[model samples]
Target: MSKPNIIQLSEFDITQKIIESLSNVCTRAVLFSVKNESKDATQIAEELKISLSTVYKTLSNLEDLALAEVDKFIISPEGKKIKQYRSRIGKVEITVDNLEPSLNLYPNTDNPKSSL
Candidate 1:
C-alpha cells in the first residue's frame, strides 16, 4: 500500500502531545486496535475487554492528540448510528536531546506492515 503522509514536527507542544499519547498503555492499546480499520467504541471495548466508559475516555484522549480520528458513521439495521474511529497514524518516532524535541508521525497506510 502507498504511504498516507509523512509529517515531521518540531513544535514542543505538538511533539509533547504525541509523546503523552504513546506513554499510556491504555491509550496505546486503543490506538493500536484501530490501526488498520475503523471501529466504534463498543467494538474497541469488546476487543480490548476494557470498560465501555474507559474506551470512550481513551478515544477522546487519543482524538485530542490527533492520533485517532472519526472515519465515518455507520447506520445499523435498527436505525441506530455509530461513529467509527480509525488510527490517524501508523507509527511515531520521537527524539529528545538537550531539551530539544522532534516528532515524526507516519500516517496509516493501506498495508499496515508497509508502514513499519
Candidate 2:
C-alpha cells in the first residue's frame, strides 16, 4: 500500500467535532470495524454487538463527518438495497499545544495490513 495522506485540522469547531466523534467508544468501534473491508449495517452491528439502530445512527454520523463512505450497495435476497460502508480514515492523531487542539487524519489505504 502507498503511504496515506495526512489531513491536519486546527479549526476549533471542526477539530472539536472530530475529537468528540473519536472520543465515543461506539463510533471508534464502528470505524475500526470497517477499516479493512466494507460491511453492511447488519454485519457491523453483529460484529460490534450493538443494536441495529445504533449502527445505522453511527453510520449516518460518520458520513456527516466524512469519516465513512458508502463503498457500494448490494441487493439482498429480499431485493432490498443495502449499503456497504468503509472507513475513510485509517488513523487519527491529536495534539494539544498552547491550549489549542489540532487533528491529524490519515486516509485509509487499500491494503488491509496497512489499515489501523
Candidate 3:
C-alpha cells in the first residue's frame, strides 16, 4: 500500500479573501487584535477601543461572509452574551508579482515554462 502525499497552502489562496472580508474598519480592528487568538466581540471592542455596537455589527458582517466564525454563546462575568470569534483559516496568502514565468511553482510542475 502506498501513502498519500500532503500539500501546503500558498499565501495567494487566502489573503485576498481575508482582505475583502476584513475591509471594514471595525472588522479589520477585530481581525488585527484577534490575529493570534480567538476573542469575543466585546473583548475585541475593548482591545481595539471601539464601541460595542460597532464591534457587534462588524462581527456580524464577518460572520455572514464566513471569514470569521462565532462560537457557542457563554455567559460572561458582566452577564452579557459572549461568543468567541476566530478566523476560519490559519494564514493569509497573497500571489507574487513579476515572476520570471519559468519556475517550478508546484509539486507537479511538468507544464512548459513560460517565456521571459
Candidate 4:
C-alpha cells in the first residue's frame, strides 16, 4: 500500500465530536485496530470480536468525526468494492487543567517528525 496522505490537525482544532468518539470503548478499539494498517470492516469485526453491524456503525461515526477515514478501496474477484479504513491520528493526548480538558492530535504518518 502507498503512504496515506493524512492532514494533520492542531490541538486548537479539537472538538466535541472528536472527544465523544474517542471516549467510546468500541470506537477506540476500532480506531486502534486500524492504527498500524488499514483494514475492511469485516476484518476489524473479526479482530475485535464485535458484530458486523456494530462495526459498521462505529466506522460511520469515526468517519463522520474525522477520526478515521477510508484509506483505499479493494476490488474483489467478484468486482465488488471494499473500503479499507485507517486511523487519521497517530496519537491523542488529553490533559486536564483546572477541571478543563485539552486535546492534542498527532498525524498518522511514518515520518518521525510527525509521530508523537
Among the numbered candidates, top TM-score falls to 2
- lDDT (tens digit, per residue) of candidate 2 on 37-85: 9999999999999999999999998877778878889999999999999
Candidate lDDT values, in order: 0.77, 0.81, 0.54, 0.78
lDDT of 3 by residue, 24-49 (tens): 66676675565456688778878888
Estimate the TM-score of every prediction. 0.78, 0.84, 0.53, 0.80
Worst 10 residues of 1 by lDDT: 3-12
Over the stretch 11-114, how does candidate 1's per-residue lDDT look in tens digits?
Answer: 32566766876888888899989988889999999999999999999998776665677888999889999999988778778788899887777878943433
Model 2 C-alpha lDDT versus the unseen true structure: 0.81
Report the Cα RMSD per candidate. 5.3, 5.4, 12.2, 4.8
Which candidate wins on lDDT?
A: 2
The better-scoring model by lDDT among 1 and 4 is 4
lDDT of 4 at 15: 57
Q: Which residues of candidate 3, in runs, are more than 4 Å off?
A: 1-21, 77-81, 93-116
Model 2: clashing residue pairs? none
